[model samples]
Target: MQIVTRLIAMTRARKLQRQFQLIERSIVALPVRTRSRLAIMTLREVGQASKCEFPHLYGTAPEQRYMPWGQGTEIGFSRAQSDNAEVALRGIALWLAVAYHETKESPYTSLQPQHRQLLRVLRELRDAGAERDAMAQWMRSGAAA
Candidate 1:
């Protein structure tokens, strides 16, 4: 029974390795080391990166767990915030478009330092497949147009 348990543990580790490799490849197009980051993040990291505290961070450090998702798993984002996050993301996308295309247009011709930072964050998010659907929503909303 001990041997069998050891074998099972080894198999799970192998599966996690493969899943992480696939995740890395999917984010290879990103220009930074975000490709190498694990999909799961700590509550503090999430809150700091997002600049908004999540309700679950109730003074406890959640154990970091590697959750290997299956093929059928679907990704999504929080919606309809009063803070107008979606509009802000869309504006960032629009400014990034102007910069990317080098249209030489005014207004969005030059972005603030933070705008550039957020743009990179968006790229990282999209490449990591965390917000592909949200990216699509921005593209379809014509808010970036």
Candidate 2:
């Protein structure tokens, strides 16, 4: 019985290790911008839930109204305005990546139309070099634009 229990425990541990490795691979496979966005969104959710203020992670409200995360007012213009376009792009990517992982569904199958649209827009920005240009400008100006 002891040997059986030990074997079961070892199997469970190996399974858990594989699961963690899979998640790590998924995260690493994601683009840097997407990872950044994921980190920011995760931080924002945690901060809000815990009522902890993270000024670095949080941004001031945007002049134009827009939903940064596609679903909630909780994550919006502040992130885009505070962080650069790359950060915003990353956040959007992260949001999609997380959604994909959690749902285990394709973006078209699992995500709402709005989210799909948001993803499209962000992807366009990334592909067009707009995000890179904006980041470069931000760096050159030494100020958030």
Candidate 3:
């Protein structure tokens, strides 16, 4: 039945949320500097996969959440086209935000237009699929589209 199929898909989506939360909790427990590095690395990876420049996370409301200033890396974003990049980009963005609370390096960071889109994505990381209301919130983030 259509109802049954919808329920199954919903179940999987919620499960994915929970799994991501578990990942976030584990990642946040690491040292702050390590978390920061990982966050930057995640940003670069997300941008690379999305076919955009790396996101500037420092100027946003959330700001970069640590210490010792992360050294800058100048890597060009280029790749032979691939259809699967979008999938990787989304997951990378979500994971970065999960650790974003630990970000804390600056002096050359400012939000790009795509970064605003990223902020919307970050907003969905909350609630961790703990309730129906939270699940609805995730649905609104357009992550499933």
Candidate 4:
């Protein structure tokens, strides 16, 4: 049964990888200016959602795609926080990287690089913690604790 489940997951992963390739190709064909504007718009949208639940567009990497607006807003908020904002900014950067390739804008007009870097760091920390938590839960559940 476990083997069957693993095989199914592998199939899904392959499908997702193909989809990612297509998304990459589309992004590469976009105009630079449009890309920039898209980033700005995406960030603006993210900022607007700062107070909501699941503010950073959280998702498991293998099964989830980040939303541009949500990522940008998270970065903006991290910037606003003024300290240890890397995680939020990183989320924004990742989304921007994907979005910029598909739009016309320059991809940092609204949010500066320093802030973006901070956001990136914060995201790493957040992801690490989540991973640790997940592993711990799995271990405990399996009587391996």
- Number of the top TM-score candidate: 3
Candidates in order have lDDT scores of: 0.33, 0.41, 0.37, 0.40
Write down the worst ten-residue block by lDDT for model 1: 72-81
Q: Is candidate 1 or candidate 4 better by lDDT?
A: 4
lDDT of 1 by residue, 55-104 (tens): 21222234421222111101111111113544322322222222222211
> After superposition, which runs of candidate 2 have C-alpha atoms over 4 Å from their true positions?
1-6, 41-140, 143-145
Which digits, one per residue and each the tens of the lDDT, describe model 3 over residues 25-77? 54445454444444455555545434412332222232322322111110111
- The 10 consecutive residues of candidate 4 with the worst lDDT sum are 97-106
Once fitted onto the true fold, the runs of candidate 4 whose alpha carbons sit more than 4 angstroms away are: 40-145
TM-score of model number 1: 0.27
Candidate 2, residues 1-145, lDDT tens digits: the string is 8677556545533433343344344445567666545555554543452341322223323433242222222243223333475555443433433332222222323233333544453354345355655676788894864
Residues 76-98 of candidate 4 have per-residue lDDT tens digits of 33333343433433444344333
Better of 2 and 3 by lDDT: 2
**How do the predictions measure up, each by TM-score?**
0.27, 0.29, 0.34, 0.30
CA shift of 135, model 1, Å: 26
Q: Give lDDT: candidate 3, residue 69.
A: 16
